[model samples]
Target: MTASTAQDAVTAGFIVIGDEILSGRTKDTNTGFLADYLTAIGIDLSEVRVVPDETDRIVEAVNALRERYTYVFTSGGIGPTHDDITADSIAAAFGVTIDVDPRARAILEAHYPPGGLTAARLRMARIPAGADLIDNPVSKAPGFRIGNVHVMAGVPSIMQAMVDAIAPTLKTGRKMLSRHVDADIPESRLAERIGEIQAKFPETLIGSYPRTSDGRFTTQIVIRARDEDILEQATAAVQDAVSITLA
Candidate 1:
């Protein structure tokens, strides 16, 4: 899992756990950042789930995602508050014991002044047994990686720092290449041709996004593929399809 092979396609799943996000009290910005970051590193983000800060919900999402994807990243519920149950939930999902990790405690101890690491703050040091710690440069409270699951902080800054810390350690696949062609035509008019083009290039992904410009409908056809030559062929086919539709 640490090295990329020709046949390997690295994929990731993301879980956002927080009741505040579900209630719209806190906006979740980590998903988009993670998606972009993973994509840039040649890891496809296959799925994303936003679950409330409930232990069962978190466990369910973690188990489901960890089983399906090459890697699973969880953000939120790792804080020191009463509702922060991600560490315990992850332990439950993996059927492992969770306790204050000495390494994490040491890191926190160094970050916090004497007696500042209160009982509540000590919660941040808890980590599932047999897990590796992910460095959190923004904050001293470290994230943990258990199995394929990486449990990170909910805060955007801290989560971003954790991602940076873990980026170099992750395996990456062939980078996905993309090309887009904007056409001055309605999507419906090019749907059939696009379908034909898609069938011709089964290895490539073709998507059509429609929008309005000056009250006129237009479409942007985007083609993606791991192989650059295939991507170019698919994009050319899409362009031809758009031109034919216009004709």
Candidate 2:
């Protein structure tokens, strides 16, 4: 299968591999980062899965998610350690051979100079055939594109950098925009009217987030749509329902 993104409503998924993540050693900031960034660029994140360092689990998640989404991004397990098996797992998932590619090797060699291409470092050079290279400014070790999946580092800064390098090449959709307003009224008081506004503005998404703190219930309503005009209209209706204005 090939990796494909659309000029409209591009749906994407993510695979995060690391025993550390599953064991709660590191709380994931990558998912939130990617979610906000991708949404701004018009790619909707459909799903995210965090798996262990096990190759079989990684392979399965990669294969399944890639086929179901327009694009798949994997983070973590691309280091020089023995447990960094993302590349090999991805290769196995696609039923492709895992070996150091000349292009990737050349790139690594260019970065590392004389003794830079050590065995451990060379392991980073193994990429699936016909994959594209993703620039890694943090370290010269590159991320590879196989099918529709872009595999990058687990480190937040490096992953963010890698995303910046490749995002321009993606086909993005019209960005979904939103506006929010908070009211001290209970959500139950606005439930019926909120539902009515949602029905009237079917193209827009209306969400009511309610929280109880101390002794009062507060609600925040968010209106979202690909079309700014529709989003504004929904926002107006929401304000009318709650009889509250937002500055």
Candidate 3:
């Protein structure tokens, strides 16, 4: 699916692929990075799914997410190792053939020394048919974008670089605006009023984050909305709620 217009809300889904992530062997940081990146670029990250290296699971998540969101991004299964089955799974998800792309091979060749492009290294050149290459400046091994899905390396630096490469081509929407109101009280004291405010401002999202400092409890109310006026109103309401509760 293509990106929606500026007036429409463009949404995205993220798929984190790797068995290590599920086994607690690797901590995932890409999800938070991508969420921030997409939000900054005006694309709402609507969903995120962490799946193992199994081809079926990858294909299932890819197909489901691709059909649901404006764009789908996948990270962690496009490497040169045998466990890197993201390319094959993406091809299967789209019912297309996948083979070594000459352009990608040329890029890898230029990066590697003479005869350095071994069979394992060549695996990085295997891209799905009708996909466009996403440049990875960190390493020469490029990522590929097929339809609305972008497959990038599992490495954080490379994935971030790939995001930069594809950022310019993406269609962005109205940026979401947010305001934070801190209350020197616990969430339990403000929960009812915050819920009432949330119901009153249906167009805005109100979230309460609670924290403890020096044996004292406090809450941070974050109000998010596309409209500045609505955000300001909701933020003011939350502040008033906090003040009234404190008084």
Q: Candidate 3: deviation at residue 61, Å?
A: 0.6
Q: What would the per-residue lDDT of candidate 2 be over residues 147-167, giving only the tens digit for each residue?
A: 899999999999999999999
Model 2 / residue 166 / CA error / Å = 0.3
Per-residue C-alpha lDDT of model 1 across residues 1-247, encoded as one tens digit per residue: 1123325589999999999999999999999999999999999999999999899999999999999999999999888889999999999999999999999999999999999999999999999999999999887899999999999999999999999999998999888889999999889999999989889887777899999999999999889888788889988888888778788
The regions of model 2 sitting more than 4 angstroms off are 1-7, 212-214, 244-247
What order do candidates take by TM-score, descending? 1, 3, 2
Deviation in Å, model 1, residue 162 alpha carbon: 0.2
Give the residue spans of candidate 3 off by over 4 A. 1-7
For candidate 3, write residues 39-75 as lDDT tens digits: 9999999999999999999999999999999999999
Q: How much does candidate 3 score in TM-score?
A: 0.95
What TM-score against the true fold does each predicted structure earn?
A: 0.97, 0.90, 0.95
**Cα deviation of 69, candidate 2, in Å:** 1.8
lDDT for predicted candidate 2 compared with the true structure: 0.87
Residue ranges of candidate 1 with Cα displaced over 4 Å: 1-6
